[model samples]
Target: MSRRGWVLFLAMSVIWGIPYLLIKVAVDEVSPETLVFLRCLIGAALLLPWTIARGQLRPVLRHWKALLLFTVLEMAGPWFLIAYAEQTLSSSLTGLLVAGVPFVAALAALLLGEEERLTPVRLLGMAIGVVGIGVLLGLDVDGAQLLPLLAIGLVLVGYATGPLVVTRALPDVPGTAASSIALFVTAVVYTPFALPQLDGTGQVSAPAWWSLAALGVLCTAIGLALFFALIREVGPQRALVITFVNPAVAVLLGVWLLGEPFTLGIALGLPLVLVGCVLATRRSPARTEPSELADVDSAVP
Candidate 1:
């Protein structure tokens, strides 16, 4: 990676990672629907102009259906799920749980007839990831928390599947434009549920407001730009390595700023899941498939 790539890479590492903590704070005050809606509204407001200026929306409209699917899978569904899960789950645990996305993404690609062969090492990686999941769940989750964990399960499926949809179905769409359109569509879809609650949002705390602002501007709008820049600078494979790095940042921020614990489950399980991600996704993707990697990269808390 070049110096520019390193700069973008480092920016996105914290940019993407801190959202889990942000969601944890903001969701404590607002409904998940409202947070998702307001965050998308802010991000779309910032990014839509760029997409239009670049004439990216014309090609995006040609594949609106796929774009809508990407929106739902990547933003509308999973973002809300992550916010909802964070209400009960610790930020560190939530980030750690999501580290399993690569495992699911690998399976998604194979089932979708992607060209990359699933070697034995990848299978072993998945097995190790599953064990890590067991350790995390066995130590941290209680029966009462099962529903939130299940929400995280849906989030995993959405985050994993969204990329495949964008890759195969929206091949011509630029990453920034696709993401901007998705955010716009998500904001529109959630308007009814989110709008009615805006009257009460004035009561939300200062930190929550700051968290929401950072989420909208830094994590969603500018974050996409930085990610596309990273991909352009360093190529998608090196860009993808940031996923392995994000959960650590999330865990550290949660533990330090929010005073969330570095539980034994996280200490043990996070390494296993991240290693699994590395091993599972080590095989080179078909060159074409990863070009819009922001599809996977952008779908986070």
Candidate 2:
């Protein structure tokens, strides 16, 4: 990676990582639906004009069905689920759970017929990642907190499947335009649910408000731009390494800022998950799938 790539990588690592913490904060004062709506609304506000100015919106709109799926898979479902999960799950745990995306993405590729050959190493990696999840759950999470695990499960699926949809269905769509439009569509979809909560949002605290603003502008809009550029700069496989960095930042921020608990489960499980991600996403020597990395990369949002 070049200096520019390093810059994007570091920037995105922090940018994407903070969303978990921000959502943890924002969801304290707002419903998950309203939180997601605010995020999308703010993101679209920033990206729409830029997308339109670049004349990419029309092309992006041409693939509305795929774009809609992308919205639901990439933003709508995962965003809400993660937010909802964060209500109970620690921000560090949330980030660690989400870090399992690479494993899920690998499985998604196999299930979708995107990758016909699943190497033994990759399979081992996936198995280890599952063990990590089990350790986190069995040791760290109580039975009462299981619902958050379910929510994180949904988020993992969405995160895994969203990229496959984008890469296979709308590979040619401009990333900025696709992401911006998806944000708009998500905002629209959540408006009905969010409207009822709008009256109460005024009571949200200042920290939560700042967190929401950062979630919308920094994490969603600007993060997507940096994510897309990083994919281009470093290719999908190398660029995906940023996922490893995200959890560290999330855990640190959660511990330092939010004063969230960091336990033995995280200390043990997070390394397993990160190592599994590296193993699962590592470039196979004889790989024939040209779009495997791109497929994983597209789902970063």
- Highest-TM-score candidate: 1
RMSD to true structure for each model, in Å: 1.7, 1.8
Q: Per-residue lDDT for 1-301 in model 2, tens only?
A: 7999999989988998888889888898898999999999999999999999998888888899988987888889988888889898889888888888878888888888976577888888888888987788877899888889998888888888888887688877777788899899999999999998899877899999999999999999898888878877877677778888898888999999998888989888988888877777776666544443246542443
- State which candidate has the highest lDDT: 1
Off by over 4 Å in 1: 284-290, 293-298
Q: Please, what is the whole-model Cα lDDT of each candidate in the order they appear?
A: 0.86, 0.83
Ten contiguous residues minimizing lDDT sum, candidate 1 = 289-298
Clashing pairs in 1: none
Model 2 per-residue lDDT at 128: 85
TM-score of 1: 0.96
Q: How accurate is candidate 2 locally (lDDT)?
A: 0.83
What is the lDDT, from 0 to 100, of the residue 13 in candidate 1? 91
> How does model 1 fare in lDDT?
0.86
lDDT of 1 by residue, 1-301 (tens): 6788889999989999999999999999999999999999999999999999988878888998888898888889999999999999999899989888888888887888863788889888888888888899999889988889999999989988888886778755788898899899999999999989999988999999999999999999999889888878887777888899999999999999999978888888988888888888776554553565533533455
